[model samples]
Target: MKQTDFVEVKQMQVKCVLCDQIEDIDDDALQAKRLRNRKLNMYLCTPCNERIAKNTKKRHKSGNFHLFKEKKDTNDYL
Candidate 1:
């Protein structure tokens, strides 16, 4: 397998807090969630994922949102 494919396989281990099921998430999705947590100490529950999305959207709309800096690109040299 290609190196990119290997990295993709490695990061698909995020589990749902409510159901205890591992989600088939790509690296981008996982990074987005982690970025949200870094900005706000928000944790995700399966039942509350939508709520979290709505709340963050509201916070953004109200100008009370926390924002994380973009991650450094891992493909710099290549």
Candidate 2:
């Protein structure tokens, strides 16, 4: 008997968390920031880069945060 290595990837299928316009993404840029040795990937559309700024503002003002949880999807782009 042989054992095979299984790789599980979780993806989110929501409209780009940044733009909130593009229902989907083509070739977007993913940047990873390190926090406590954990890397967090941030997804954004070229035009919607400003959304990140806006998000920061909301976090600063209301102390509220929105996170995009990963779901299982085959259309994930690395």
**lDDT, candidate 2, at 70:** 31
Candidate 1: residue pairs that collide: none
TM, every model = 0.32, 0.25
What's the lDDT for residue 22 in model 1? 60
Tens-digit per-residue lDDT, 13-53, candidate 1: 55566567565555567554674467634335556688778
Clashes of each: 0, 1
Tens digits of per-residue lDDT, candidate 2, 1-78, equal 334445434333434565565433322313322211246444455557676778778786664322322322323642
| Window of ten residues with lowest summed lDDT in model 2 | 27-36
C-alpha lDDT score of every prediction, in listed order: 0.56, 0.45
- Model 1 scores worst on lDDT over the 10 consecutive residues at 65-74
Top candidate (lDDT) = 1
Prediction RMSDs, each to the true structure: 15.1, 19.5
